[model samples]
Target: MSSPSSTPAAPAVDRLRSWLQGRDLAVFHSVANRHWPGADPLLPQLSRSANHGLLWVGAAAGIAAFGSSARSRRAALRGVASLAVASAAINTVGKSAVRRRRPRVDLVPVVRRLKRQPVTTSFPSGHAASAAAFATGVALESGGWGAVVAPVAAAVAASRVYTGVHYPSDVLAGAALGIGAAFALRGIVPTRGQLPAPGRPPGEAPALPGGEGLVVVVNRASGTAPATASLVREALPLADVVEVAPGGLATALTDAAGRGRALGVCGGDGTVNLAASAAATHGVPLAVFPGGTFNHFAYDLGIETVQETAAALTAGDAIRVDLGRFRPGPNGEDGADGYFLNAFSLGVYPDLVRTREHWSSRIGGWPAGVLAAFHVLRGQRPLEAELQGRRRPLWLLFVGNGLFQRVGPAPGRRHNLADGLLDVRVVHGGRTPALRLLAAAVAGPLTRSPAHAAVRRRRVRIAGLAPGTPYAYDGEVAHSGEELTIDKLPEALTVYCPMPL
Candidate 1:
């Protein structure tokens, strides 16, 4: 046999790996002997809980269900996405490629050892990766929840070392890897430059001389609360209150704008959309109050309740927001074309909207959406769309005034109010559009499928549609005849948002 000196050289990485492994093994041995008697029950359970990432899965689901806001749901979903990235990396790449051995049971007491020992290589701890990914991911979305879970995640990551399944270095590397995964996903996911900030934006926002000049219109018929008018008056004592019939909001807002120094509307998206037009036309600052089933616009603006909006108005904070203008036919030749404050869509999407309206009162917004999807998907058909002058069949077409986060079947939540880009998402036609949509909902927008596309632009027009095509705009429905035009009115509406978008 050749002398030991004649052996081929090992790569520098391998040498470094070995050196680190040796140093970490000593620490692992020390940790194995230092655990308290209570750890026998706690550490092993933590180890088993993170074995298949079930602990993180439950955490993500809980966050998604905590609030009715789209922001809350999206935050939970993004956390889940981070966990997936970490799990895939640790299993398919980190452990198999590095091939670091797990600590020997001889160093650990028999009672302290994990009941269901892992059989895989332990270069980096999978549990550590999951804990870091979920905690870091959730923190970025919802800070309150993130603060709540951070300590638990840290304890879980440390548990792997105490259990003797992972060296201290293994846990460290796994945490670093998991955090990196979350940052990588942040760019790919719809989070950057989203969420309105507390401040002001450039433009001619009116200075509310005082609450006396502010006119807030209350829609008593809107939302779940029975005392919307009472709430508004109580919140803004000095401001004038106008009560309008649900159907007469437009004319009342037009009449109100002509009379008051500033205009305010406390209602849902449908009422707000109408009020937005009159506010823009009369050059007045419009204050928004959140009093709807799903306050998409106000939520995006960071106003969660009437008192919050009232405080902002009292403080004279306002911002400029973009409005999406749509025309039923080419170049808006049809007089029926109008503007929307939130979102507009066609194809199977419109059907879903219509169905939701029927069941919303009975089942609530989110459940209504689920029920509508099931019924609408059964009879969904592809629509021949002329997008950017390119003809193609599509299952759904969505356009938003500003960039909205894609969380479920529909894109919801705007990050900026005046980015001047219409965020568009398309579901490509497939043999089974409904099933593909369901999968996207379960797996997220980043899931690999040949049927999804996203775009951002200033203008988009669609032609070659069948006459009387179903259309939905900001939760309301209409019929289009063979063609449509969509565009943005840059900084068209001056609204009193609680924060600068």
Candidate 2:
């Protein structure tokens, strides 16, 4: 005897399923028979191009190549990643879970039907899923790019039904799954827009309409400088832009800061560091343009493009951020100093930077970094430094201007640029430098492991350095004295940034 619960629901469920299938077939037939003007030749080729995600791949490559900004690269990467997830899901589970057959194409026009039909079960259309995933992912990162891709994605989904390879229900289900995949990926690795703006206090600065009072100093040697500088000119036509050659950054920045209502800088972290120092000393608001291979300071500030910074400048949106300093220099309290806008590090990092800089112009930045890492890890010895009153052997000592948080595996950003704390991280002395560094990277910020430890402090002092021991700060390597102190200047620098929505 069948239980009441099981017997009653089985027939009802079967009836609903039959009803849905009939409706699905009706829609599929309607789409197949309908005449779509100009869709016959265009859609079939578009559908064919999207086979195995080749079209999306090509689109992503194009976006990355032409977009020429960090946001574009990120959008392309996110789109591809979302596509991968959606494709895997459709192949592994979605297709097999519901074995719905493809629709009959007799009603479909001969020219509209695909030459080669899909053979897989069609409960969820993989093409629709991939298209939705890629477009949704791109949109999540960049609205403009997403707007451009969404129509193509919708057309691809429509083509599945127009060609009679998938029912409307199949396409709908697949697109839903694809969108879900994009959101899931966003949850795993959030888009920059999702992150909160740096919790920094706002500062007062002049609203430069068309950047009338802003003076921008461009580092000619920095990555994409010419292109970005040209963008700056186009974006802020009234602003005075000074392009400085190598070894003349100090004079140019000093002069720019002294004269302008606000000082703007375009370059890498190292160049930004000099600008930040000049701005702070001259008591002027600073604007940053990301014209570098790695614009760590600018990206952390959420100023990814010249347009963003220009917008901030036009509106006078500014905030106070902490400045990192190491003491005992040519002049100042505690004997003058040098400043680092991003981080200060000792041990293998300095050597790696030196080596990478040496070879970067020759072999390219990424490969040079890899080669530097290999050379430094293989040849460099652990640093012997006195920290917190005790002498110890260490592989690295990193001190950041503020507390840095782990985005995924390594420390990627800081949420509070004005926080009066130094993020101090260290990897203990070890035999295999590569393993220790890798372990530290995997360990992440504020987490301690057997190989590495991280802590936050108002001040950090390291001693017992050998004469002319190389240390790196903000991608610039230099020699240091026997003892060095790292500290923060709370809200000492004012920088322009777009206010978070």
Candidate topping lDDT: 2
Question: lDDT tens string, model 1, 1-501?
Answer: 877765566566678878886888788877877857687888778778876778878877777665544556666777788989998988788987888677786688887777777888887888888899988888887787888778878989988888778889889999999898887888676452353362235445555534678887766677643366677777677788887768777778988888988888877888788888889889988888766677788877777767777766766667888889998667888776589998888888788988987898786777898999899888667888788799988888878788765533445556678888887777778889877665544543323457766678788889988888888888888888778899989888887766542
In model 2, which runs have C-alpha deviations exceeding 4 angstroms?
1-15, 34-42, 104-117, 328-336, 354-381
Q: What's the CA error at residue 431 for candidate 1, in Å? A: 7.0
Any idea how many clashes model 2 has?
1
lDDT comparing candidate 2 with the true structure: 0.89
User: Which ten contiguous residues of candidate 2 have the minimum total lDDT?
Assistant: 327-336
For 273-345, candidate 2 gives per-residue lDDT tens digits of 9999999999999999998878988888888888999999999899999999998522224456899988999
Error of 2 at 420 (Å): 0.8
State every prediction's TM-score relative to the real structure. 0.71, 0.88
- Using TM-score as the measure, the top candidate is 2
